[model samples]
Target chain A: DAGITQSPRYKITETGRQVTLMCHQTWSHSYMFWYRQDLGHGLRLIYYSAAADITDKGEVSDGYVVSRSKTENFPLTLESATRSQTSVYFCASTITRYTGELFFGEGSRLTVL
Target chain B: AQTVTQSQPEMSVQEAETVTLSCTYDTSESDYYLFWYKQPPSRQMILVIRQEAYKQQNATENRFSVNFQKAAKSFSLKISDSQLGDAAMYFCACMNYGGSQGNLIFGKGTKLSVKP
Candidate 1:
């Protein structure tokens, strides 16, 4: 239980509603990421944070927003959820981007109707 | 742009047999790394194996091994003596160490099934 953990393992929301997926890691990793897993697209990075107060967009980041006010936590928010945004979200953390593999949380699945 | 491609969407194999999953990538960075991750039904992402581009030798871990062909821009995962637990979605990913942020480009997964 010392590794990364996600909140609301499963969620259901309506379109135009707001949803936030929470991610926290005990490792205090400098780098954290949010990725969405779809059927044909595999896993696409939504957003990433290099450190506290520093976040950047990824390949599919238009509908997602993230903030890393703390090194251990990175929460992704969908301001206006859509049907296409329904997917499994994974939170990952790593000590350094140069080496080592990322540690992922047990994913959070979201459904929008 | 960097990209990873997994041609096979699904594959089946007999228990105790061997199966290979193919992956190809396009990247401009000479020094990078490739990884194979297994996503079981539990939906946890587990690292299977990793290979560095500069290293000529492939990487292996127990029953899992990778055939990394840097020249051909191909990396394949081979699972020997497959078991029932090996049935899951396998993904191939690439990361450029020299690039910015070390963001990983992942390929579409291959769902592997082990038939008894």
Candidate 2:
């Protein structure tokens, strides 16, 4: 495909368990981002990567870890999942780090119990 | 920190009619970017339109257009000849300039319903 894709569209995990959300983009964008969407909060950024091996924390980065080993893949990991983490996660990518449009994935709905 | 505000939590418009969704933002920077994104039940964030702060003219794309009032810091989206397909959650986002990296700050979003 020519767009961004997220794996495991629906995931259910137990509290304290580790879960990883995978994000892949075919455009090879330099900037990749992870955001969690919830009711009343809209979307909050968790993490973003400028390029391979360069990543930074966003507005809501606690409990979530992200790594970008390659330009096409940026994965987010939850070391110890909590019930509060249950929400729809979105992955986005842009061709430029300055001024560019963002292409989003279908999203991953993670339910923690 | 820059913040985006979408005042209308929900709105409804009849098919083939025009509807405008309001958005306001707070930022001290003179140069920046604004955007309107649509998310349907499929949960895909699609860019509907974008506007540059420095530009005086509004940006339009097909049936979608924006009313950008830089002095008031307001950016409203106007959808002409609304269709059922336009029903979705619309979010307004802001991005500041002069930063080494670009990250969007989004509003709570407004849910638009197109009635037949």
Candidate 3:
């Protein structure tokens, strides 16, 4: 794809199982982010990476883990998936840290069983 | 911490008419940004329009426009000549430069429905 893409658009996993959502961007942007969308909360940032090997935590980064080994890849891992973790996950990228406009992927719908 | 709030959970507009989605935010910092995002049935977040806090002029893009009131912390989106394609979940988000840069705090969102 020419733009950002998320793998496993639809995922279902059991409780206590480990699952990872993948994000890849072709724009070679400097910043990448992961956000979870729920009914009442809208979209909350989980984790973000400023550049390769540089990452930071957002508002809801308690149970989530993220890494940016490469500029084009930023993956979010749920060590122990729970029912509450079932939500639509979106990966976004921007050229600048603060002022740049964001570009989001289609989103990965994860269902916890 | 900055917080964005979209009071309206849903809004409906007749085709060819105009509709406005309201959004309010709370922040201590003076410098920041406001944005409106659209997520259709496909679940893809698309940037509708953006308004900078420092700019006094409202931002307009085609049929979309924003009324940014910095003093009241209100940023409302107005869509003119509404069409069926405009039906989607519209989200209001705020990014604070005082803290993290790329991190965005979003409101609950308003689902806009266009009736033909």
Candidate 4:
């Protein structure tokens, strides 16, 4: 795809299981982000990477882990998925951090039991 | 910490009419950014419009325009000649440069319905 793409558009896993959501962007943007969308909370940033190997935590990064080994790839992993982790995950990228314009993926809906 | 609030949880408007979605934010940073994003049924987030806090002029893009009030910390989106395709969940977000530049604080969102 020419734009950002997310893998496993729909996923279902049990509690205590490990799950990974992959994000790939063709734009090679410097900024990549992971956000979770819930009912009342529009979308909360889980993690963001300024560049490869440079990552930072967001508001809700307690149970999430992110790694950016390559500029085009940023994956989010939940070592031990819990019921509270059930939500739609979105991956976004932007060329510049100043403008705040983001291009998001189609989103991966994960359901944890 | 910055917070974005969209007071209208749900709004309905007739096709070809105009509708305004209200958003308010609280931020300590003097210079920041405000944005409106649209999420359709496909769950893809699309940027509708953006406004810089330092700019006094409101931003207008086609049928979409934003009224940015820095003093009151209000950023409202007005969609003119609303169409059926405009029906979606609209989210307002804020990003401060003093903090993580790319990190955005999003509001609860307003689900807009267009009646044809």
Tell me chain A's TM-score in each of the predictions. 0.97, 0.97, 0.96, 0.98
Clashes of 2: 0
lDDT values, one for every candidate: 0.94, 0.93, 0.92, 0.95
By lDDT, highest first, what's the ranking? 4, 1, 2, 3
Q: Can you write out model 2's per-residue Cα lDDT over A1-113, one digit (the tens) per residue?
A: 66999998999999999999999999989999999999999899999988999999999999999999999999999999999999999999998755747899999999999
RMSD of 4: 0.9
Off by over 4 Å in 4: none
| Candidate 1, B62-86: lDDT as tens digits | 9999999998999999999999999
Off by over 4 Å in 1: none
Per-residue lDDT of B1-116 in model 2, one digit per residue for the tens?
88999989999999999999999999989999999999999999999999989999999999999999999999999999999999999999998865556778899999999999
User: Regarding TM-score, does 2 or 3 come out ahead?
Assistant: 2
In the order shown, the candidates' Cα RMSDs to the true structure are 0.8, 0.9, 1.1, 0.9
Best by lDDT: 4
Stretches off by above 4 angstroms in model 3 are none
Question: Candidate 3, B87: how far from true, in Å?
Answer: 0.2
Q: Of the candidates numbered 3 and 4, which has the greater DockQ value? A: 4
State candidate 4's DockQ. Answer: 0.77
TM-score of chain B of 4: 0.97
How do the candidates score on chain B by TM-score?
Answer: 0.98, 0.97, 0.97, 0.97
